[model samples]
Target chain A: MPVFDQGYRRFEGTLRPRHALGALVWTAVRPRLRWWLWLLAAILSFYPGLVYAAITFITLAVGPDAFGGRNRLPEASGAFVAFSDNGDPSQLVAELLAPTTAGIVARLWRISEQCALAGFVLPAVACAGVIATDRATGAHQIYFARPVTRMRYLLSRIAAVTVFCSVATVLPPLLVWLETAALHDDPWFAAQTWSAPFAIALSGAVYAYFVSGVVLALSSTLRRPLVVGLATIFSYLFLQVVSAMIVHGLEDKRWRALDPQYALGGITAPLYGVALPDWLQTPWPWLVGLVVPTLLLAYVWSRLRAVEVAT
Target chain B: MTSTAPVVRVTALEKRFGAVRALRGLDAAFPRGAVGLLGPNGAGKSTLLKVLLGLLEPDRGDAEVLGLRVAADPMAVRRAVGYMPEVDAYVSGLTGAASVRLAGILCGLPGRAAQQRAHEILYYVGLGEARYRRVEEYSTGMRQRLRFAQALVHDPELIFLDEPTNGLDPDGRDEMLALVDDLARHHGKSIVLCSHLLHDVEAVCEHVVVLREGTVALSGSVDDVRKLERGTFHVRVSGDEARFRAAAEAAGMHFAAQDGETLVVRVPDGAGAREIFRAAHAAGCVVRRLATVEQSLEGVFLRAVEGAAEARA
Candidate 1:
């Protein structure tokens, strides 16, 4: 037998018990992440706040009369009464708060629009390669060969994507809500709708589920990261656009069943107290919303095995 | 060394891939030090390794590695042992040291300890400078050594090296075999080298377990396993070969093979060439050449596996 002097010393340190799973969360993911994705998340985190800031400026500018002053700024028409009203600024502010149902829907729609925009794009992009790359490059063998189980492996991988997506989707809206409340002097609205924080958290959770569920399922099925990412983003946008077009063209609430956006909006709209027209309140959208994530989760359950097919 | 239990004691181990049976009642006990696991392609060697590592659940039976029952406490087995897989497997976009250190931490080492060990083990495997580079940029030999380093970074008591020299050249292959030998002897590590190359096994292994059709066909210490029949010698002679054979038989010598002027003859265990020389002299045949030919590992392996197949049939 051939022998060479290695001069290697034995490791005389104590090993922690059953720490492989925790270590996986720390070191399982390769640190060389796409910098652009994080940049996008950071950029997305500013969206709700930016929109709120812009709207706050606009509301303040358009309704300067509401601050116990006369309309000294600009003149407006019948629809712009909040701005054109030359009455007591306090009365004008209360009048704006108790606007018609259509007015509430229009304002709530704008918030939903921003949330939907970030929620759809951020989750799809951030969670694209959670498991796909592991399968692609045969890293699962490296993990499984350690003291980790399939469940721990899957959870960590999901957590890697889920946490990042939550940063982009959940945490931002929460911050934006705080910023909006702190800046706004609307006590009546705050009393009636103190659940804004909880609603943002719930909506953020919905977005995270879409990411961890559908995107993760797609990741498990494929071997290429780029392909998984594109597939996720494309599917999210495609289904949202197609369902919206079909529902609008038909002018039928029944056709809205296919729209995941509609379902998310339905759940989101109630939190904001947007009075939904009875024709637009279809449970199919909600059911589809739940079913899609459930099916994707089930797909992941059946697919991600220990001895995965070699790369 | 104080532990008397076998390094690995597997009984009736069975694993299946859907309808196809991968391991069918494989029973073998691997001992300490370098033990080679030899098998043909698809003979369930990889499956056995995965099962022992707890990467896959066995369909039936029990297995214990390093005195830890795999079925009952697989994490303990994984904690005590390390594995270098057969395929190209690594977390992409990681430097060799970073990858090895991550493997160490995941195997239960603290970060600082894992980092120190990673550097030491990488240096020990002759990749001290190369460890700074991403694994994707490594040569085949470097990747093999890197994987070996990862397996050692945690100071595991036992390691499973699967196809360690798969894509190496002759010199690299020699280097890998030498490393295996050094690790087993100097480092006091027990290793299971999974390879299809018999020469590699013969070079590094003190004991061997051969698998065929998911069962142990032959297993023993390398010396006994490859031992030739006693006093067997192949003699190539020029004059009166038949007369030489008859004379050899008359002298109570048994001939093993005949091909042209070449003759295989076996004397008693302790008997030497004196008997064959005397018989050749009596026959008046010129003994052109005579030498003992030891049975090679390839011969032993082919015979064992073929014999098992015949018995199964």
Candidate 2:
């Protein structure tokens, strides 16, 4: 809240509690209500991860003994394992769980990355579509004509998209973890795995925020939401593909800046186990990735504020 | 003579869209009345409303509403004036009540205050029963009323209504017109009613301004503009047309013969039908018909726009 006191008038400087609550509720409910199809699409998008998880689970269940003695494992009961041959029970249990744990971990890592990408791209498309629909139906003029400033309106919209992206990213992995814990009775296993979903969800939300800022900036300029959404998605993909092909050929580090995806990859390499030089991992990329697009969005919003509603 | 300097004032406002000018060096003032903005299509009526609402910037000149400059202190002006856009646009999934309440809160109303005001304004606009209904389910007329409801929910001193009767039935239009009239007449709220329909303006507006090609063509009280081109009178008589013509000419009245039995004469300003009756009686004519021809708003609007266009050419 910011105060503005003129000579004769005393204008209230703080946002009302109801407005903040309404913004949050609107952010949560509007995505599900306005574009349930997109929500469904988001859920369907995790099918690849689900398939990978299932394969890993089956491979782990039928131990390395299924691939011959190159991997020796015992048939295990709920509490412990008893080897049929002369074998150490603790050693057999370790061998049995190692491949399964490693596979699940690898799959989780890949799934988390995919989740981050989907979370960013899906909500960006949905929010742009929603705003475009409002403009097409003349609803934007009515909404903007109210006492609310353009900044408040855009903030509420972005908040809603972020909530949607976070929910989409976190829910699937949690469900999978819950199912695994229910079947395997591995308390340690569940505890070790829970942190991945939380981390993925947090990072995914940040990514979604950045993507939404860019998409909304484009959305304000373009008349058609679908065209804007597709162009943004395809353009990012095209840049990534082209950058991958040409980066190997480039000698200069500046060429990396041409590809946002590569730049983001380099930025997030620390979290993903791909180490960068200690000097390069200074939080600058995180700030740049998030703040630059946000400023661009603010510029777009000011332009929209100046637009006259066509009656 | 000096109350507060009118809620809104504009001096020599001008706006251009590419090569075609929308608002050409126009000056107007809105005091405390339900002022009607009468014009034809492309008359720059919409442009004027947008500029006054602080949504659009003018190419030249300045405007002040409630002592706040529109360009520099738009938020203050916006807080003081409620606007009902020509089109009906509401948050799609929101109920009528919620939408109005949201608008109230955005205007800085506290929770309980916003809710109470929303209820009162919804009832005032005659949508009390349908307050819980989603806006998508509302009819064109209901939505129009809802738009009006949102504008009034904040309890602003001034309101800008652009085509408030658009997409309304005859009865609905009448209801809206009456509501607008009551706001100005009884409550003392100033309003700028922008509409192409003259009848709508004539029903409630005390002051009228006609715009053509972004310039003021005719303005002042509705009576003053209507009186600019006075209506004529047709008197039918069972007497010689030549005699009636001679008498009319002698009296320095402009008269024309229509068919063989009627003499149409221009009714001078301030002269009534009784004068025509007396003239017929003096002429020894059995007056069978005496009809005072009145001009329609459409006719007045066309004549004004055409007059301005011709002058510009």
User: What DockQ does each listed candidate score?
Assistant: 0.39, 0.18
Report model 2's TM-score to 2 decimal places. Answer: 0.69
Please write out the lDDT profile of model 1 over residues A254-288, one tens digit for every residue: 66556555566555566656555565577765666
- In model 1, the runs with Cα more than 4 Å from the true position are A1-6, A18-32, A42-49, A57-113, A123-127, A185-195, A248-250, A268-283, A306-311, B17-20, B228-291, B308-313
**lDDT tens per residue, model 1, B76-139:** 8888898888777877778999889888887889989999999888888888878789888998
Chain A TM-score relative to the true structure, per candidate: 0.71, 0.65
Off by over 4 Å in 2: A1-112, A168-202, A221-263, A270-274, A277-311, B1-5, B229-292, B295-300
Best by TM-score: 1
Top candidate on DockQ is: 1
- Given candidate 2, what's the lDDT at residue B45? 86
Tens-digit lDDT track of model 2 for B196-265: 8889988998888888888877778777767654646667877865666666556656653354666567
| Candidate 2 chain A, run of 10 with poorest lDDT | A1-10
